[model samples]
Target: MIIHTDRDLSLSGMETFTPKTFNIPELVGIGAKNIEEHLKLYKGYVSNSNLIINKIKEYEKDPVENVYVLGELHRRFSFEFDGMRNHEYYFESLSDGKKEINKDGELYKKIEIEWGSFENWLTQYKAIAMTRGIGWVILYHDKQTGHLLNQWIDEQHLGHLTGLSPVLCLDMWEHAYVYDYPTSEKKKYVEAFFENLNWDKVENNY
Candidate 1:
């Protein structure tokens, strides 16, 4: 809950992850109350991620007796870790106020190359965000193929394309917009997100 401008996340070993503080100002349609609550959820993810790691280490001592518990904790770790990272990306994109996507930037060029035009890409990405589930719509840069790909991550951790780096992340979870807009009006929330996006931060991610 320390709101700072720096976007880099610190992860030291297994149990040490410091939740990032985002300097997000008042947004367009997303209210201060919503962000304040969302930041608390992000903090929970960070804390739970660390807790899972610590519990796993403790359980490792009695490997046979705690094997089942250790397995469950290991599986749970990704959910917490990805939740922490995804919120970081989502919050960071909305920081430092709204900035238009630079037409001349590398990210823009890649979007055009991949989806024919920027609008086309936006249309597809928005549609993906409307998928009926609580998850994230992400635009990722696949380093192996040297291309950008759009993905829908189910429940923060599932359905993420392996080896790809996320360039932009949109939280589609109801908790993301429920405070501001009803479920039927989530598209408005999506529009508000784009309106408040800091394209400079997103471009840096790419």
Candidate 2:
């Protein structure tokens, strides 16, 4: 595992998350059954995140005696917390309704400034989503540099940029599409995800 970032660390008074509800419409390629199951996994992440924080609090009652336990719990918290957060980004993008990216938006200008054109960025981001593992393809905004960067995160925690925030998140975990596409045809699921995306929601995140 990578060294813990501030987000990966278990804080003394971390608050639990309430799983968010998405107003998702019928989507192309991706079936309703697939979405129903996906949301369940999202909820599991939220509950597990809460459980981990609560467990850390219990272990903290005896910091010296539970040092090892606390250490491991702190490390484990990031996976669950990021899982919850990443899904929120993914699901929200597919929520409300499908719409085209606004060419006039700040996000569009940023994409163009970084990659020369929106299509260039989309092509590269889609290729990144096809990375050979269960992970995420994220578009992050670096506040310090005022730049956008694409990153591939391994297992919900590793590879996140320090001091940056993800404006868009694509879950490439097999579970995200197991009900909609075979492993060999995951590209179709990627296509389906974008087909249903609400770029407005992603812009709001930025």
Candidate 3:
């Protein structure tokens, strides 16, 4: 991976994203090894993102000859970029140890308005997390309506709701729990994730 600080400027003199370090602590069901390996995957996304950007620059030197390759690279960029971003949200929410929810926060109040109660929202979100696929479950704040919505993304770059901002993200991929929990018991992993969640981080996202 390209290990560099945020101060490391790219060729365009713009800041490129390096893999972010999370201050995660011990959790209830998720093992240290699980997180260690998961962070490695996150770094791969970061690496691939930088690699793709550089390759695009290289290919653009002959935009005529390398048109096809450049086209494909452009197509693949979102997958890597979104993968990096989504994991940041997922890991950050679990970072800095676990913090309890602020019942008076806007996120909590919004959930109550949107779903009638916090429990209702959580029940629905957890069920959405159990969706059969390798992807993510996200809680998005609909930008236009200011309403909270739950969405199941099919992959890093697919099925994203346009104009909505993600407030919370949960990785539903087997890699998120394969080492600690079996496939059939993935719900336990979800429960464990909430057990150690930093709702304060989630509130910040909100």
Candidate 4:
């Protein structure tokens, strides 16, 4: 469920996703065949929990915390992707990966140490499918320091903390869930978001 912003996802590519029956004509170009299709895809993403847990176990080689930072990433991606699909990617107004400093700009060494090798990171990045919501959790590269960091945000606002460019993002918000589950089942919805992650895509993103 944790998704790298990029990676290969032939089955879930932007080309094949269909839109819904009642969606506005303005949204036809947004992908999906229409609005109802979009909504279905959104709910389906929400109900993929086991995939989330298992994927998390697969991604963390170092094990920073038993707590899965990547799963949280997916939760955030769900929120962000839905907002964009709905043309709500911009609300209050705006928004915003890999590397380590002290390497004297050594690309190969940095890739090996900081990311467990470039190939591994690539595999880890592109595994998630569509997500829903309004907020975003992102991964970024601090261009100046050449290090990577993951951060969380509630809206488009930034600068509370400053760092590199965005490597990945996850959206989090209610509109993402209200359509699929009653407010009471928010926990259940969160639990079910692991079925369709595109690991290939995530690896590419990372």
Candidate 5:
């Protein structure tokens, strides 16, 4: 059993998420399905494991002990709830040395404003992806200002898109699908990723 303080859940200083308005998207699409499958495979053990880690990250200072036995009700399903949906991205040229026309693509415009250039953004994204443990490498967007911030998390429980809201997230957690797919074949997983994308939800979030 473990407990987490509000401060730990809030990231460094991102204190805007409230349970009433902060809705987790419905776990749909390949990515969502993968997350669901990952949860089921672990059968709640993962949640228990995270609870311990969350306590270590959040409540060591309290000196109080709380034990919680997560029941079936707390089961984590695929991200399936109203307001939660897959995201969409429009192709933007990643070439260097030139500033091109807007071409009227929503994602292209957003990327330009947030990251300077698509090339620069992707370079940073790839770097984050390969840097650590399994989880996700996300490009979080600030809904108000359209800023892009790169972040990663271990388990969906830990990472926050500091400074910006989450615009995009790529799950790198091995359990997300590494069982059905071999761990060495990440390229295939990346390719299959396109099969279950829900861009409409992402556009709505923006």
Candidate 6:
């Protein structure tokens, strides 16, 4: 078994992470109560991430004795960290209200190149969001290949593409839509997501 050292974790001596505040206005379809509750969940992830890091440092006093504990903490660290990061992407996309995608922009051109047209890409991406299970549908830009790829990330971290930058992220978890729609109506939630998306923020992410 491979044991993770502090260097392997890469969180050593790092400052604690603070939760970011989002200025989300009243959205269509999705309710204010939903955003309020979702923000609380985001804060939880941020708090847990900092808690996990501090715990790891405390446990590192005796690496040999705390090996097993350290191993589990290392595994859990990704979940909290990714949870925090994914929410940042999701909430930021909804900030400053909705704005249409720039059709002549680089991001739009890239999508057209990859999927033949923007409509085709939107159809396919919406389908990905309806994927079975509670998780997130992410549109990532793979710097290595210089291409855009849509992915389904299980929970907070599983199935994430390594080395790719996330451009758009849709939270498909129950908490994301339970307040606004029933589980069977999540497709409506998906549509609402696009309707309220700040494409400018997404394009900047590219």
Q: Which candidate is the best by TM-score?
A: 6
Off by over 4 Å in 2: 1-11
lDDT of 4 by residue, 61-174 (tens): 445663467658555544434433322221101111112222334443555676787655433432221223344455456778878654555544432146455544443455
lDDT of each: 0.91, 0.91, 0.90, 0.41, 0.46, 0.92
Q: What is the lDDT of residue 174 in candidate 5?
A: 65
List the candidate 4 regions with Cα displacement exceeding 4 Å: 1-134, 159-163
Arranged by lDDT with the best first, the candidates are: 6, 1, 2, 3, 5, 4
**Deviation (Å) of 82 in candidate 5:** 17
The residue pairs found clashing in candidate 6 are none
Could you give candidate 1's per-residue lDDT for residues 1-206 as a string of tens digits?
A: 44324421222345468889899998989999999999999999999998997787678767889879988998899999999999999999999889999999999998999999999999999999999989999999999999998999999999989899999999999999889999999999999999999999999999
Candidate 4 matches the true fold with a TM-score of: 0.34
**What is every candidate's alpha-carbon RMSD to the true fold?**
6.2, 4.7, 4.5, 19.9, 11.0, 3.6
Considering every candidate listed, which one attains the maximal lDDT?
A: 6
Model 3 pairs whose backbones collide: none
For candidate 5, the 10 contiguous residues with the lowest summed lDDT are 86-95
* lDDT tens digits by residue: candidate 2, 82-154: 9999999999999999988999999999999999999999999999998998999999999999999899999
lDDT: the better of candidates 2 and 5: 2
TM-scores, all candidates, are 0.93, 0.93, 0.92, 0.34, 0.49, 0.94
In model 2, the Cα lDDT at residue 35 comes to: 88
* Winner on lDDT (2 vs 6): 6
Residue-level error in angstroms, candidate 3, position 198: 0.4
Worst 10 residues of 4 by lDDT: 90-99
